[model samples]
Target: MNRTFNAASTADDVLDGIDLRGRRILLTGASSGIGIETARALAAHGAHVVGTARDLSNAQAVTAAVLSDAANGGSFELVELDLSSLESVRRCADRIADSGPLFDVVIANAGVMATPAGRTREGFETQFGTNHLGHFVLVNRLASRIADGGRLVVVASASHRSAPFSLDDLNFERTPYEPQLAYARSKTANILFAVEFDRRHRARGVRAAAVHPGTIRTGLGRHMGQEVMEAAIEKLSAALVAEGQAPFQWKSVAQGAATTLWAGLIAAPDEVGGRYCENCHVSEVNDGPLGPFAEGVRSYALDPETARLLWRRSEEMVGETF
Candidate 1:
């Protein structure tokens, strides 16, 4: 594929002329933010998009535009899925698995950011459990439902730069709990899950890639106070200016979802499979100091051994094997 997109590109820009009439895609968190734009763009381009949400009523209200704006054969549907509950994940996955239509791509886009310290319905740390473990079970269970030449896109974050995942203390039982660090760990797990998943399924033509949608102001930040957010953004902007990069500014939802669409549908499978992608391209390994505004992926996020280890530990935690 030719390189024409940048951080400023929107989802529509990434798929400007692409036709997806016969394609089928599964997307999570379709009720808000980048997920809404992603579903809109895909369905507008004639793809059959099945979106999952925690509340069917709320999702329906927020996504009327998806149905109203579809062109050609594009369409959208919704299913109930609560990532914090394993039983809910299973029911949703099982229903989709039995529905008979194979998916051309599955985007694990639903997630929680830094929440006050808490646990999931299954007792794992809230961030790790909701953002990582929930998708782990849902995706692995639906593995065979993916088409032979398909894609799995996990929505990770650049915050993985700060994540040093520990096999021990995954639930923060033995150590001090920090909300941001917990979110960082979950983002790392998202990338690592893609790494190992691509390794496992690439032989059969299914490829997985993790994407960092550039920081956007969304409901994802509801837990953070306005003053705290402003201070952090100020500091980040100063750091970027010092490094001679553009001052920090949040991406539009359309811009934020561009990389997810590009990595999932536009980029060659071989180019993006088992990699970390941002700005609509595969990122290089950078083990340097943490830069949330930086471009390169940390070496640990794409480490094969660590990916495998996390896969094993995730399976154990969820009480299922893939």
Candidate 2:
């Protein structure tokens, strides 16, 4: 992959001329935004995509739309997935794993951002539970069901640079809960999960990667009020201007899903397993504090030891073994 795509590339742009006939893909948060475009493009390329949404009716609507317009392409099915609940996660995984064929790729794309302090039904921090732990358990339960030479792509965020992860207090149990840091920590966990998953499963011919979709004005930001969103954008824009980087702007949903598409379908993509990617390329690794609008991955997010530790804690938290 010579990095032919950028932050502005759409899902269809990345999938141009690529064939995916007979492939089976499992994609989370598939009803809207990046998820919908990813599903549309991949299905357009002849991949049978099993897309999950918290609500099945909404997913069905999206599926209907995808199918009605596709003159020639693979198809889509809907699954009910609620990432905030382990019971829901288990049910969704079991349904998918038992009801049909093995998945060729799994894209964990649904997530919440900048949410207020709250706990999941299982008593874990909401963001960590949904963004990392929920996906962790879901993927682990389905790990063996992925076809040989399969790929898994976890959609993380550049906001991961906002804070460092604290293993000792992943749930904000002691430290006061900060919404931004909680979201950042969850995004970092997404990366670490990918790192460890690739390390553990590469021998099985399964590769895992994490992606940072560029800033996009998706429903993921509905949690943030207008004032909060404006202030954060201003802050990041100021930092980017200071760093001499291009000014920040919202990318299209298709553009946002392009890196995820790249992660799952790039040529010889296994070579980049365990890497944090943005703009359809393996981002440079930077040490020390990362500015708000920094471009590369923080070395801390890719730390091998931390990845392993996160894996152990994740299994314990999920109370399951792969």
Candidate 3:
């Protein structure tokens, strides 16, 4: 696939002239930010999108435009899923898997960012539990429900470069809790999950890829107070400037979602499987300790051995093997 899209490209821009009639997509975090835009663009192009949110009524209220204005037989449906709870993840996956038609694509887009020290209902770190482990369990459970040749696009972050993952200290038991580092570790786990998932399923034609949506101001930052948010932004800007890269420029929701749509629908499976992508193109790996705003995948984030190890540890954490 040619690289025609950039950071400024919108989801609608990426999907233009593409027809998705009869396609079925499962998208998490459907009620907010880029998730809503992604669902709207797909449904507008004739795909049947089943979206998962913690609150169905709120999701319906927010996505009314997508449903009411769907074209070419496109449509949207909402399902309840609270990623912070393993029980909720299991119930949502079981309901969708048991209910008829198989999915053509699954976008694990829901996530929390820079949250205060906390634990999920299942006794795991809030960020890791919801952003990585939650999707780990849900996606694995639905693996059988995805049709052959299906794609899994996990919405990771360039901030994955923020910190290295520590499987041994997954819940921060030995380390002091720092919100940003915890979130970064979780994002790295997202990439590793995609790497391992693609390796495990590609032979059966189910390929998975992780994607960076760029910086976008959304409810994902609700956990960060204004002063902390400002300080973090200033620090990130300084680092990028010092590195001779442009300062961080926030992407709109549409722009943020463009890479996800591109990776899932436009890029060839072989090119994207087991890869990390951003700005609508597969990213190169940089082993250096670069600024979080820098573009490219960290070599550590894609190590096959690490990915495999994470998979094994994750299974043990959830007490279920895929």
- Number of the top candidate by lDDT? 1
- How far is 159's C-alpha from truth in model 3 (Å)? 1.3
TM-score of 2: 0.94
How many clashing pairs in candidate 3?
A: 0
Estimate the TM-score for candidate 3.
0.95
TM-score of each: 0.97, 0.94, 0.95
Off by over 4 Å in 2: 1-3, 238-246, 289-291
The number of clashing residue pairs in each candidate reads: 0, 0, 0
Q: Give the top-scoring candidate (TM-score).
A: 1
* lDDT per residue (tens digit) for residues 189-291 in model 3: 9999999999999998999999999888898998888788889899988988887888878899989999999999999999999999999999999877565
Worst 10 residues of 2 by lDDT: 63-72
lDDT of 1 at 216: 95
Candidate 1: stretches off by over 4 Å: 242-245
Candidate 2 lDDT, 155-250, residue by residue in tens: 999877777776989988889998888999999999999999999999988999999988888888888888888998988888788878877788
Residue 82 lDDT in candidate 1: 96
Worst 10 residues of 3 by lDDT: 287-296
